[model samples]
Target: MEPNNEQAQGLYRLCYRLTNVIYPGWQYRPIQLVRIDERTGNVYVLAGESDFEIKPTGGYEP
Candidate 1:
């Protein structure tokens, strides 16, 4: 999928705020924004299925 500059900027800002990590440099994988229904807690990734969550494990490096 094509990168959305606005979304990318928002993601980068959020990343920096949360972890002090700059995107596309500090992160190895493509990071995406997701939305969840507060009532249902159903999560939806912004860039569709191409950008889904990968839970970090104990041995996870990125």
Candidate 2:
């Protein structure tokens, strides 16, 4: 799917503010470019060794 700049930026802001563990460099941890599922509106982010799946409704699914 084509990457959405606005979507990723918004998600990054939300995640960083909500978790404080996802940010620029995460202050030391690794931060990778996020991937989004255009079909399901699911966002995937990898930080260090952690993986997150953010739902469209601003929810996290396990």
Query: How does each model score on TM-score?
Result: 0.31, 0.51
RMSD of 2: 5.4
Candidate with best lDDT? 2
Per-residue accuracy of model 1 over 2-53 as CA lDDT, tens digit each: 2245444544444454444454544333335655445543333444224432
**TM-score for candidate 1:** 0.31
* Runs with alpha carbons beyond 4 Å of true place in candidate 1: 21-62
| Candidate 2 structure quality by residue, lDDT tens digits, 1-62 | 64356555657665565456545444544556578878877788776667767766555542
- Residue 31 displacement (Å), model 1: 8.6
Once fitted onto the true fold, the runs of candidate 2 whose alpha carbons sit more than 4 angstroms away are 1-10, 13-28
lDDT of each: 0.39, 0.62
Model 2, position 27, has a per-residue lDDT of: 50
Error of 1 at 16 (Å): 0.3
